[model samples]
Target: MSKKISYEFLEGIQLPITVKKDILEINKESERLLFINKIFQIF
Candidate 1:
């Protein structure tokens, strides 16, 4: 799933992704969450 995300509260989060591959990238920098209100339709 290659979907772009835009939010309001992405400040300072942490992501220790050692094994990099095909994965959904999200900003984990501040107060905002990595995956919050996103819904996927795999119907």
Candidate 2:
């Protein structure tokens, strides 16, 4: 369930863009990392 949501943000990462560029990719990667950290913290 959570993984599905994480993947949603990771998708379309290859599209050319004049947006935040690498920042957006880093943000998505960070989100996944934070989710992992939280899951680990629970144990």
Question: Runs in model 1 with CA error above 4 Å?
Answer: 6-12, 19-22, 25-43
In terms of TM-score, which candidate is strongest? 2
Clashing pairs counted in every model = 7, 0
Least accurate 10 contiguous residues by lDDT in model 2: 15-24
Top candidate, metric lDDT: 2
Model 1's C-alpha root-mean-square deviation from the true structure amounts to 10.2
Cα deviation of 28, candidate 1, in Å: 19
What is the Cα-based TM-score of model 1?
0.18
Q: List ranges where model 2 is wrong by over 4 Å.
A: 1-27
Candidate 1, poorest ten consecutive residues by summed lDDT: 13-22
- TM values, all candidates: 0.18, 0.38
Error of 1 at 10 (Å): 8.2
